[model samples]
Target: MLPILDWGCAMYAAVDCLSETATVLLFDPNAMTDDGAAAWFVDAGSLAEWLETWLAGTGWYREDADEYEDVAEPTPWETAASRIAE
Candidate 1:
């Protein structure tokens, strides 16, 4: 699992790579602690497509929240975006 965004609340967004696909898993702190409930699971395709899906907000990882406070800059996402530009 490659973590992309961390809220410092134990809730985080991560990418899980599988043999055939890549997925984004959003975990809720309390719920995960209680029942291992993932807030979101999205099949975002390959690494590049996953980044695109994230930016477009057309997948399971929607921009439902008003805003997200980044615990750190998501450098991987930036790197992926740059790759797409090339």
Candidate 2:
């Protein structure tokens, strides 16, 4: 399993196994601002592609945050991953 994306409050990731194609999962902690383990399988795709599609799609957008300016910033998890890769 490879850790792909972290939205600070949540995570979008994938797993690879010899037995199956890669599976993407979304681990959302604060679903609709309510407390619960709100996680689900997203889809099968590379992290980059998935992230790009998400950013391009309207379903992930929230009108209140000034058109998702927050999306431009890398999450703490992503920063750590970049450092580790370096």
Candidate 3:
């Protein structure tokens, strides 16, 4: 995966080189385990979408953004990550 954006605290928005259609959002590694665990989530469907969300000022990362409440949380991408890593 190639990281395109960093949200501090070890979080990032990355492009999956394998699928290329999906964007991976990573949380702080502190929540990760030692047993091949991950803090990755399948967030935006594409970089364009993520950028759109940012431009609209409704990013889920925002403290005051309504998207945080209205939008469903990104799903875990551990399976996809493992598959892609291979």
* Highest TM-score model number: 3
Instruction: Give TM-scores for every candidate, taking all chains together and pairing residue i with residue i.
Output: 0.43, 0.36, 0.74
47-82, model 2: which lDDT tens digit per residue? 555556567663343455456653332222222223
Sorting all predicted structures by TM-score, with the top scorer first, yields: 3, 1, 2
lDDT of 1 by residue, 1-86 (tens): 67887847776767765425655555554643232333434334356776776676654445553355432222223233232234
Off by over 4 Å in 2: 16-19, 31-38, 43-86
Better of 1 and 3 by lDDT: 3
Clashes (N, CA, C under 3 Å) per candidate:
0, 0, 0
| Model 2: colliding residue pairs | none
Worst 10 residues of 1 by lDDT: 70-79
Q: Write candidate 3's Cα lDDT for 9-83 as tens digits.
A: 777777776675666565556657664346667777777787788788676677776635676467777575566
Of candidates 3 and 1, the better by TM-score: 3
Misplaced by over 4 Å in model 3 are: 66-68
